[model samples]
Target: MTSDTPEARSALRDSASRTLRLEQQAIAALVERLDAGFDRACELILACQGRVVVTGMGKSGHVAGKIAATLASTGTPAFFVHPGEASHGDLGMITPGDVVLALSNSGETAEVTALLPLLKRMKVPLISMTGRPASTLARHAEAHLDAGVEREACPLDLAPTASTTAALALGDALAVALLESRGFTAEDFALSHPGGSLGKRLLLRVGDLMHSGERLPRVALGSPLRDALLEITRQGLGFTCVVAPDGTLAGVYTDGDLRRTLDQHSDLSGLSVDAVMTRPGKRVSPETLAAEAVRLMEDHRISALAVVDEAGRPVGALHMHDLLASGVI
Candidate 1:
């Protein structure tokens, strides 16, 4: 059998390292090119009354779709329209209130450039991201971002490797900048992504899911154990608050307490709720975030908690099931 030589290994390593270096150089070039033009592009998108229409061809099209999604999830409304599709009836989606962001390494993708005249006729602002600022698309754009790369990662420098990566990063930078400029909040992001976990974390508040008013499981301190059990069953929270006669949270009774009480006393009906209730129970305030409440419940190995007011009066109750049902946990 022939043995592998150090020369072959060294050559392969050098090629791989060179490709990375070229890509790094491409990204560095993009950073240097970021200036007033980038700012103008961001401002144009922010001022857009309609959505940001992103279009590209081939690999650039994939990046454009991702960029559009990032913009939509963050605060700016954007959507990707394939350049080929735009030549058809899809061009109707573009309006004067919208900003058109066209992506092409050569700045002259035939499919994308074909729509330029129509976009101009509609008076829609054009923002170009391309490797060649002197290309036709860049020359006609209101703002041109130089997404040029030093070279492709491919050995023959034929593929759109480094250039595409640089363009995608530049697109992300623009979207994030526009998001910040518009004062986009987490809640705003959640509103756009209502089905995602981030939306649950940001939009699910304590009050939104907490059990309130008469639905809250509560028993007066002097109430019998049977009454406490009835309260827990009626509320279906696995526990009940033990309130003092003056309407203050005195303690809590749970299934655990019932088991312990039943073990010590044969007749639970004769026992007072205070006699079986666990005193100084862990509680949460109405203002606490529902996610935080979930953490507290999990950490304590408990299923429910009373939401107490500043005066220590029980106003509401929350169960782990409530959080699970609301998609907060």
Candidate 2:
């Protein structure tokens, strides 16, 4: 198959298209197969006092692992254990209160089938996902999920392509249904993924990233420009918040204002901080998302903002560098 040949290119495109269509049809078939067994499977998992123990062999094992991860991240506690490993010693991980989800395309995989008797002896609830409903594994399961597909996408019909895709889709359906029934919120998802970008966006708040207490640069309303400059330098925020006698934010005096004052050739001897400050500058609440803070900074073309309370008092300060250091940028 030469890269320059039209015949080879056509063959590749046709093969990809056929594979995608076959997988699509396989997943579509699962929609009608959603019978009472699905509800029972969900009920078993939901009512499980312990975690959902997922087990399978070969390609089914890979799908089982992903399903277990999805379940754990979505609010249900679950983990994957290989059927082969279970026979060795990992069977001890399966407690009596846990629900077992077994995956086998033919439902006759030796490793998976070997565990049926032990699971029954332990009195653990079994939910089997197989292509053959009448197979031994399915017949023994408390609830059987039929994930059969019409045909494999492989030309030889030996590789597990369409069947695996259907099983993965069915597993996703179960995870989503369980998630909805448990009312799993995005905050809960964030708690499970606190190291990723999604976690930063959902879990990091303004208060977590803002500089408070002595780190907040501030100058009183009647203070001199020189005093505000000292506060800005001491705090190293490139700006200083102006506060009223009652400690409420009055305005903001940034380096930009200093440049403008210099352009006007204004004398620095008698200028109060309020005389050259930008009043009512953009501010954010402590509970605001750090991602939203980035948007506000980008939209207004500013580098710093005062974190204020409900009474308009400057409680904290945030700079662009703060966000960058916190990985919110």
Candidate 3:
């Protein structure tokens, strides 16, 4: 088959489609296999006093690593230990309080199976995920999850294609179930992923990005429109917050408001800030998530928001620039 031949291209596309279909079917079958064993696996992890130690061999080992990461990030304390390394001293990492989750498509991978007796000796609960229910690993486990697939995507029926996909889907299902059972919030997930954008969305609060104290652009309600414009210029926020006599937010005056004011008349001396301000503008609490603040700004077609205290007084101000600079937008 020539690399650029039309027949070869067609075959390549067909092969990809067949592979996806096989994997999809494998995952669909796993959904029906969620039975008492699945529930028992969840129960064991939930009841575990120490972290979960996930181990597997070959392609199953790669899937095991991903599962361990997902479980760890989603509120379950988990880590992957290479099965081959377990016999070489990593077995000491497993304690009596820990739960061992072993993955193997055949359930007969020698490296993974060899650790069974030691795990049993440590009195650690063993949860096995495998395609064969009658395999050695499955027979020895306290709970056996059948991740069986009808066929491999490999044309030779020798590679771990559909089986590996089934195992990955099952691992995701387990992690999501454990997450729900633990009442894991996005904030909790962010605590484990502080360097990612998801962490920013969940952990970045309004107060963290807002201009507080003297940095906020503010003017008294009856202050001249000229004073408000000057305040906006001084703060470089494109807007100034209008405060009432008690220092509570009364309205917001923006460059857009300024344009409208200038178009109405050439006289700036007679107008008060309240006369040109957009009244009853949206306000957010200091504790609000920065993402929520961005949503509020987008929904209202406004570029700025006042951060107020419980008493409705302006404690800080936020602009689109601040959100953009903080990667909240």
Clashing pairs for model 2 are none
**Ordered list by TM-score, greatest first:** 2, 3, 1
Predicted model with the maximum TM-score: 2
> Model 1, which residues run further than 4 Å from truth?
1-21, 210-220, 226-236, 243-250, 255-269, 279-288, 295-301, 307-316, 324-327
lDDT for each candidate structure:
0.88, 0.95, 0.93
Q: Candidate 1, residues 34-67: lDDT per residue as tens digits? A: 9888988988998899999999999999999999
1 or 3: which has the higher lDDT?
3
Give candidate 2's total backbone clashes.
0
- The candidate 1 region of ten consecutive residues with least summed lDDT is 1-10
Candidate 3 local lDDT, 45-151, one digit each (tens)? 99999999999999999999999999999999999999999999999999899999999999999999999889888899999999999999999999999999999
TM-score of each: 0.82, 0.91, 0.89
Question: Which whole-number lDDT from 0 to 100 does residue 214 have in model 3?
Answer: 89
Q: What is the descending lDDT order?
A: 2, 3, 1
